[model samples]
Target: MTPQPFVAMKNIEKSFNGVPVLKSVTLEVEEGEIHALLGENGAGKSTLMNILGGVHQPDNGTILINGEEAKMADPRVSQEHGISFIHQELNMVSDLKVYENMFLGSELRNKFGFLAVEEMCRQTHEILAELGVNINPKEYVRNLATSYKQLIEISKALLHKSRLIIMDEPTTSLAEHEVNRLFELMKNLKKTGVSIIYISHKLKEIQAVCDRYTVLRDGQLVKTGMVENEDLETITKMMVGKAISQERFMHEHPFGETAMEVSGLTSTGHFKDIDFTVRKGEIVGFTGLAGDGRTELFESLFGFRKKYAGEVKINGQVVKIDHPRKALQAGIGYVPKDRKENAIIKDLSVIHNMSLSSMGNFERSGFIQDKKEREKFDVYKKALNIKVHNPRITIDKLSGGNQQKVIIAKWLEAETDILIFDNPTQGIDVGAKQEIYQQIIALSRLGKAIIILSSEAPEVLRICHTINVMYHGEITARFTGEGASEEEIMHYATGSKREGIAIG
Candidate 1:
């Protein structure tokens, strides 16, 4: 006599290589509701979602769709059942055009069976407009920014008439305005009887958009309740098993002489008139909205962009770096964003990836010393709280947070005096994020000069010693991290204010 829920996964059990990832987990989603899946990085959230998306099969479970048992044998079968999964790591093909990537597997066709290019582009334009993104649908995906690519992924999900959409960290690369637009669109979708399984590490965004919450810890469901009834600290405690403080990190140690100084750094279309100095034991952060050129500016400094006008001094001595090798040789290390494409070699073992940048440390007699590498990796593994059953496994087998830890270990092993981290905690959970912040602070305490690039203003405010706000390829404001507020940062980030202070 009672109506059935739209979707249900009852008593799901899964394991990988004898390690239980999900233990008798159960979930239910009503029609047209936004249900948030919350957990720490390795807490089995992805494993559960993968099962629903048909990327993996559960060892034991009953998945019911509208009260009928549904066997999700493959991703295609899941798609047939009106499920759309927007993955955290983007799945876009760089070589394809925007519209082409949008309709890659499900292409529209004319009566003659030829590709309906015009229709596809028009539809792409229509969907992107809903997200306030304007791009040439015929343009190659490689040319677009990460934020635009993220929007395209969301648009792809909307293209399919999915009854339930599973979004994993959908707003990771989006700007403030763009994220607002997405929330609006999600609300509209919910109004049309569509359900969403929202997975995000950002607790505030979950509070903003999700209607209900489910917390998973150590591969088991710990709590499930309405979002309005619980506070963020309570939800965070459920996810991480402790309370996390939002206070700014205190640095009482005095900075040493400038480790890196930039004067009049300019790249024609990327950034202009950039001037800053990072001293030993200093943490400097640059933040802004999407397309603000913060990433490009740092990419140039790291030698990824060769053509730039600047005077760069490392340890008070001028240097020229035109390649990544030269940057490394200059004692400048970079941990780039987009870990899948730039940070990790998926096929390589976890220990090898950790030692990739500093192979010399593990080499003797022209041969790599596996024992030495593993020994060094063990130190970082424990310090970073990396969860890995075996170091011999490929780096791709680790969770995203663990992969990021490996990348950080690679740079630390290199012993670079100057370090740059772009979106360091992009996809990591709150607890893992706190650990990374402490690591960065520890590195600074050890006299390493650190530069961080983040789109989130609050992140910079939390850890950096100095905060620089960028807008339209220019540094619009500079404030001491302790004195800066999110409101003031947004004012400069949006190009509504312009003020600069001398950086020493």
Candidate 2:
């Protein structure tokens, strides 16, 4: 008799609101092998994983473990079957301690029914040490960094003695060193006969860590094969259905006078002595690794951090923006990072979300003009090629790329002369990214000043006219899009090199 694969999800199908997300998908994981689930955003990766995690039931499928059909009615049942899921947005409670979060729902108790705090802490320390994480088990999760929080999530999976672990974008927030550490830990886990289903958009990391690969496109399984047999381009083609171009998008534009200027911008602990100028009809970019202060600097510029000391000028006039309303009034609009948390209102309709920032334009006699809002939405919907069945549905029902388009439309309607987009295409896929880049270039051609803050060097290189690198709250390097290389940017982003003189 032949041995069975550790886990097999066969003929899975799922749909939402009459739209199929997963269609007869089959995934098999061998024990001790690191399997990759690759797909573009909205390619049904999340839907299939949610089914395996017991967050949703498949319309038709069989989940087998060790060749026996199994039923996973809920998350608890999945846990009982030795399946663990670590989500992209972590599920840890900030107020709780490390060990407390480790054993949150399934707590250890003594024979008298008393909580076994010491035993839990000891176990947490042992697991963390295996991953080279050195931290107090009693420390509050709120004080930990994002990477530490990510490790805690991974550790929780181990605590469950999970035979099969599902990691979704596990290294998104990790730095280079931390990511290396995680790779080592994953290797060790594999050596111990644990199977891992790794899901991520970072192709380089997927190539490095994944043993086998499965590509999904348009809710169907496109291919399943060994990672060693395929190249990045081939995998990307399977995911997006076409080859994605990596050409530079910066071209000669009729740039107008400087639209926004910042001099001596300093916020004690966040960012310091920042100076830069963004001209009308040009797109400037800020790129760096985690903790480079790019996000904080932009947040302060957008008036979210009022305690900052800086000289901000708009169209060559000094302006004071102590709040977002003032920033908007000054013709400076900010599209914040982490769109789900900072930009969109989940409960609102798609049209309402698009018109939120420019509500006054749709109001008559202190009442909203629904007809006018709908008309405007239709224009943007067509312009952006947004995929939505109905404008009345909730915005959360849309894909990541479509939701981002709606947010961009909202700011465009506000007629802000200068737009600051922080990680505009963070969770979006390659095909949708081309459309977004085109839209941004069109905006710049119309004489709107743009600032894009991104962590990805290639993204900044592809879109921006000028690129600025930040490190430890300082501007470390500047380059024209024509000359900036990823290696050059990384040297400054990691604080390996710096310029002596102030530049703007």
Candidate 3:
């Protein structure tokens, strides 16, 4: 006989500005089950999960917890019901001590209503120890590594004694070994009767940890099935709702000229002893597992991360990059991974975001931001095919694909000779992805030096003139056009040793 589910959501529909983002989605999770919610970028998976967490109210739906109907009016209401969401973007206050962060707003108070600091720290310490994470609960969260902070966040959820835990892209900032540890922790938690809803773009991890997967695409339920019953290909097809040409994004170009050079570049906790060069008219894809430090390397180059050890030069001339402003001065443009967090101000208009980074160009006497200066932004705005009635509408209303296009537009409007795109196609649909690649190729043809860091192997193989495999804070293998092979890169990236490789 089938047991009644612990939590169930039925016929959930959500919309923003009259656009349907989630349509009649149904999902059920039993106690002790690790259910994965699978979908491509902007596929309403996040929306559905957000609705469950009381982050957003669904337009139409019924939510049931243990056969009892409930409407969560706030995140606290959801938490009171033993449901907690660990967002992909870590939200713990960095300046606060770890213990303070863990028990934030839920602090235990003494008889006089004063904060019981030591009591909270002791409990936090015990929890961290139980999770097999080595750290003092009193340590500052900002000083800790990303992987450790994530573990702390997980510990925070467990502190609530949550019955249903939803983790959104929790693996993005973890090291390879750390990911393994997390999977083990998740499995152990599942055995203890805690239901987990895990969401991620990393396909391989889903195959290992999830028992069942509920796929969402274009705001509707595509299907729900057991993970053990499906292979990666089937899962991919379901996520996209059709056969997507996975290989269409790959087409290497014949790159030319040394466009940018880095020598002995280093930054604390970000990158160390980095040295590489990008050629004009070529796409050089940088691939490594999450937390392998690929993004850090670019951040260092872009002047966001201060360079403490080495030098960067463009076209064989030494450039001074003391800051991000200096990096742009050196003709380098960067598109960050999280479009909302790093790339876009969602409250601004589409053209506003597109023109933001390049706004300095239109300034007159350092005062007025000329309206005519926006003409430069319009060129790329139309070129990228942004879906908007006008550039004056706030950016948050556009689709994920259009938001990404505006980010690209922000960089293109800058007169940068070299560009670094970090996971530029992360959360968009197939057609938008195709259009983005087209834009990239167009940039390469215009002799822009492009360096892309992507998890998708085929995306790397298709666009890059040269591919660099990074592992454990070093470049493991450098593959050129003819020699580029996915198997070789993966093996090296996964820590397989090859001769003639030593911290290169």
Highest TM-score: which candidate?
1
TM-score of each: 0.96, 0.91, 0.84
TM-score for model 3? 0.84
Clashes of 1: 0
Kindly report which residue stretches of model 1 are placed more than 4 angstroms away from their true locations once superposed: 502-504
Candidate 3 per-residue lDDT, tens place, 1-504, comes to 788798899999887778778889999999999998887666777678888999899889899999899998889889999998887656789899999999898999999999999999999988888767789888898798766888888888878888889998776656666778788888988999999999977778899899999988777888888999998878888886666555634555566789898888766675566778888887878988765678878877777666468877888898867688887777888887766556779787777787787667777787636476567656665565555656787887665556777887787667688888887776554545656777888888888988898876777877777788877667777887457677877887877854544332
- The list of candidate 2 runs beyond 4 A from truth reads 94-98, 118-151, 365-372, 375-387, 399-405, 501-504
Weakest 10 consecutive residues of candidate 3 by summed lDDT:
495-504
Answer with 1 or 3, whichever has the higher lDDT: 1
Quote model 1's TM-score.
Answer: 0.96
Please give the lDDT score for candidate 3: 0.79
Select the stronger candidate by TM-score from 1 and 2: 1
As a TM-score, model 2 comes out at 0.91
**What CA root-mean-square deviation does each model show from the true structure?**
1.8, 2.7, 4.0
Estimate the lDDT of model 1. Answer: 0.90
lDDT tens readout by residue for model 1, 229-348: 999999999999999997898875899999999999999988999999999999999999887989889888988989999899988889998898888888999999877677889899
Candidate 2 lDDT, tens digit per residue, 1-504? 767999999999998988888999999999999999988766788778888888899999899998899888898888888899987666889999999999999999989999999999999999999877899999999899767988899889988878899998787656677788888988988999999999887888889999999999878999999999998888889988899887888567878999999999999888999999999999999998888889889888888889888799999899988898889889999998666556889899999999998899999999999999999999888776676878899998786557878997887787889999988876666676777888888899999999999988999999999999999999998888877889888888888888653233
